[model samples]
Target: MSILYVLLTTFGVIFLESFLVALGNLRFLFLLNVSLFNKINWKHLLSLSVLSSLILDVIYHYVLGTNLLMVAVPLLIMMGISLAVPLENSLPGYSVKFVCIFLYYLFVAFVPNLILTGQGTVITGVMLGGMVLKAAISVLFCVAFDIVWSRLRKKEEGTKLRSL
Candidate 1:
């Protein structure tokens, strides 16, 4: 099924990235609660990812005039990464989410395109527009996912307390 493929690919990419970052001594993986991702309501994330991918596909096709898998796949990857990682308290602000999305897009989307396809361009005005759009979508989806996660987590906690 397509859902299985997406989950497999997303997890594979996340695992590989975490491994490489560990090898590189980046320690970025410490920011995440890995178990939370597996436990969190995945159906919500999956639905959002698919919707975001389709919307991005249309945008890229119509606006950029390029069928760039690089753009879309990385968006999905970001969705996974967002779910995996928790924001630090010091960085607690709305801007931090956008920053996370922007960095993810830059490193995951742009750098790979440069290395693999030999295509590199400065983040220009037009590219910034697209980046902003991507970040907006990421923030929106992240917030929605968090809302559902919090509600579900609270309900579970309440049930546990009641059982005691």
Candidate 2:
């Protein structure tokens, strides 16, 4: 929940994508996991997300303007959706949050690269398959993180109750 932790996690994802060959492409899943299930304020999260995207754009030699657009569009869509559907801490709420974050990651990961490389707007079979796999992996990891964090929180609360 701390800003330091948030920034470190963002940089960790960057490091993973930049340095690790086998896990490089999993940054999307990692970022989505952090973003969807954190206690950070939306404003802080938005700013940090943009900052991370800028760092990533420079590191990847991305086109100057595309990264900002890629960051903003999905975030704005998420913001709009959040207004329509409040984010509660229940199963259906988690489902909505996951769906929004899933779409956000897909757009951020796929669309800008396509534009930057001048690839025409065509979603090929391989690309679609990759998207599905990424979604599955993201879902798996997010759920795991949720479970672990919930248990940790409960244990922490239990300790507090005993001390009282």
Candidate 3:
């Protein structure tokens, strides 16, 4: 259809999806069933993601250009990976998501700029070190968020059981 329309739409979705993923990343519960993470609340995630993105789109739009591809594409890929390589709690799954997210951000930092601008990349020890530093920071934030959410969830569950 319209490239401009798709551009804006995708840009908006990029913003919204990032926000939603931030919320999801903060999610600490359902840690056991990582395989069904999307399937279980896919509807809720989809609706909320759209709404948040649309609202933000109405605000100010960032000129992301082809970087917009980073929005949903990797998520779909990760979902596929999760589905194909089902990470059972009896096995291990959380770290898989962590690695995926880390790699996704790493791509966001270097890949888009290289692809869109056609500037070849120079991979150096320092650059890799910086990426690792940033990724580790993200892990810290996610773990902190998870801890808070987990405690809150447990507290709520405890109250519910008491009421029963």
Residue pairs whose backbone atoms clash in candidate 2: none
lDDT to native, each model: 0.46, 0.59, 0.47
Scored by Cα lDDT, where does model 1 land? 0.46
Would you estimate the TM-scores of all the predictions? 0.41, 0.64, 0.49
Q: List candidate 2 stretches off by more than 4 Å.
A: 1-7, 19-24, 33-38, 64-68, 82-91, 105-110, 113-119, 153-164
- Which window of 10 residues has the lowest lDDT sum in candidate 3? 26-35
User: What is the per-residue lDDT of model 2 for residues 1-164, given as tens digits with 9 covering 90 to 100?
Assistant: 56787688677767765653256355452345344433435666666666666777787678665555665665566567667776444565556655655565566556777877766466667765666666556556666766655555554452222333
Q: Where is model 2 poorest over a 10-residue stretch in terms of lDDT?
A: 155-164
In lDDT terms, which candidate is top? 2
Which candidate order results from sorting by TM-score in descending order? 2, 3, 1
Better of 1 and 2 by TM-score: 2
* Every candidate's CA RMSD: 12.5, 4.8, 9.3
Clash pairs, model 3 backbone: none
Q: Per-prediction count of colliding residue pairs? A: 0, 0, 0
Tens digits of per-residue lDDT for model 1, 12-62: 545644564456322121122121334435663444344433443353333
- Model 2 residue 145 distance off true place after TM-score fit, in angstroms: 2.0
lDDT of 3 by residue, 38-155 (tens): 4324544444344433444344242343333443555566677777676433123445555655565566556655765777567678766665655555555555554554555444
